[model samples]
Target: MAKIKDHPLRYDLVNELHARPFPALTVPCHAVYVAIKEAEHAVNRDRAADRAHLLALLDRNGSPHPQPDATHFSGAMGRHHLKWESHTEFVTYSAFGSGVSSRAFDPMEADVFPQDWLAGAPGTRLTSVLIRVEELPQDEAEMLAKLDDWFVPESLAMARVVDGAAVIAGDFRIDPAGHMRFAVFVKKGTGERRVGRIVQRLCEVETYRAMSMLGLMRARGLSGKLNTLDPQLSQLISGMNSPDHSPEEVLQTLLKISAELESLAVQFSFRFGATEAYEAIVTQRVSVMREVRVEGRQTFGEFMMRRYDPAMRTVKSVDARLRGMAERATRAAELLRTRVDVERSAQNQKLLESMDARADLQLRLQTTVEGLSVVAISYYAANLLAYIAYPVTEGLGLSKGMSMAIMVPVVILGVWAMVRRIRHKFH
Candidate 1:
């Protein structure tokens, strides 16, 4: 029996699921993470540049290079192990090293990503995060005391996650050093692999949050543009029912307004869609962490609800407003088009009626001209017949006057009959 052939992409597709493996970290380890993206058109930017930059970092650390088309890489970068992944709109690098800093969430601990190397990045930094991971201390108040000094009290979100395996905390605010901070207090006896998963989820939550909020900025700008169009569209719609302007003019204006609205939809469609996806991801990442409340402290989910939720809602409201306006413009344009067609139809009906009246007048004039032609033809025919019969009548002792008089009626009748025959054939 012949062996069955394997599908070409079978192995590749399966491998993809396991490609970006979660890092295995023991307690008392810290990670420095940063996501970089272009200022504009980041999704479609030259991906080769991103790869080259990753290669540059690997080269500096004397690390083995990843495959030419690799989308993710994990290797040693001097004292720290680097994990790099390319994403749809950005690239992220996480440098994981053993032990936490004595200064709580200190910036100097992130020296794995050097200043000069970060400056040579292919894009701007979307977010830079400093994560401090440590085993839970014996006393809860000790952790609480450290948190107060590390993060802002008003914005801090702290939670016990993974069924009390760890307590995670972050302020959701950029520090003076321009990096966001998170502290993970791993419960003793949690597996090394589990610790990595917790940290990974934290990174995802922050990354997606930042990406999703981009939509809010776009939404604000869109509101300004829509504000300008709303009044113009309203005027055109109002003009549709007015006698001051013609239907054609109103329809033209409606068309322009509709086109403008459609253009805006097309321009922002991808960004809005991406925003929604990112928002869902952020929510999902936070939910899976299974956060439990820290006493007198807000959980990560609650923090998002109070602050981030409003921004996402604003983006959604703006998107909805844009759609509503587009729909309004479309309905108005359709109504105006119908009105223009109706008016043109009325004008065409008048034109057709005038043509029918002209046709009737022409037919009457032709009939009158035909009658006059018959009379003239018959007069000449009668004269010729009188001449022809004059000789015969004279020989029969009949006068020319009687001969001409008798033939006149017969000649006129014959001429009328002949004309009728010719007209029937032509018709």
Candidate 2:
């Protein structure tokens, strides 16, 4: 066992590599040491012959020899103590029971390939490599040159060493006991930008995928309602669902469908709201009209009492004037009939009185004429008698004149009495 010193720069040297896990070649240090020891032993046994043969093979093949395929490498290392595995075509070489390994040399395809000869041994400590590099002599220039080539500085800021038979990134070195080890260091900022680019690409792809899904879902919903559509509208909707359409185009069609739906919703809402408002107004107006009708009836009754009654009095006055004119016309007609009747009655009474007066005057005139006629007849008869007497009396003695006087009075009396008797008979 080697006594190891604590190295402060060891943490910085391996920080980057330890930050992330990487697929690389790994081999146990014990297995690598054993393989080197076996090669040295083989060289000592037939040094002259083996050296000549190695030189000839190198001359013939070239500087770096090509590794065999995976199957060939696996078969060759199957009997070794170390077990080798490939990750993403990179080989991981380690001892079967060792907790340590060394990664060196990339394969042709950039894979990590494990050496077949190193197997079945324990791993060396990371401190062993630094101790071995410190033990190398710096006496001769050629020896110093060899050491310089075998061990490399870890980085600009860290002091570290790399020493092994295969100096992957440093100078070769050996300890007092002839054991070997290799450096394990990390590189910072390696492949970080590449990873970031890959992550961004993934995000963009996922976003577009989500948008496409949403458009398809909306298109499906629209298609379900197509049957109730108008003929002209259905034709337009059918065109949007065509098999050749892209998701973006389908989304545009869905936007147009939403526009039409919004317009219909607005129109229906306006009509319903307006109709409700109108009905309410009409109901209010009817109530107002009913109130007005009641008021009008009451007002008309009051008008009949205040204004119409006075107007009716004026009408009665005009009626009285008309009645007076009708009565005057009736009275005039009656007066004319009465005047005609009175004139006729008076004329009839006058005619009857004149006839009576004329008859009475005729009767009085007839009586006077009869009295004169009797006086004349009696006077003649008396004269004749007197003449006879005178003749005889002259012989005896009487006068004819005195006898005429006496007969006149008696004749008047007899005419008057005869006239009175005739008048009585007529009565």
Question: Which candidate ranks first by lDDT, i.e. highest?
Answer: 1
Query: What is the TM-score of each predicted model, taking all chains together?
Result: 0.95, 0.21
Pull out the clashing pairs in model 1.
Answer: none
Task: Kindly list the per-residue Cα lDDT of model 2 for residues 1-427, writing each as its tens digit.
Answer: 9989869888757863543332222222112312111221021223333233223333332433223322111212222232222222112233211123232221111111122212322221111121111122224344335434544422101111111111112222343433333322212222433322222222222222222222233334433443243343444445543568643454454445545554443433332333234334433322222221111122212322353334333333333333433343334334434544675788888988998898789867876776666667556755665665667655645455665566557756765677678779977
The most accurate candidate by TM-score is: 1
| Shift in Å, residue 113, candidate 2 | 99
* Candidate 2 residue runs with Cα over 4 Å from true position: 1-293, 297-327, 342-364, 376-408, 424-427
Q: How do the residues 147-243 of candidate 1 rate in per-residue lDDT, one tens digit apiece?
A: 9988899999999999999999999899888899999999999999899999999999999999999999999999999999999988787767889
Mark the 10 consecutive residues where model 1 has the least summed lDDT.
38-47
Q: What TM-score does candidate 1 reach?
A: 0.95
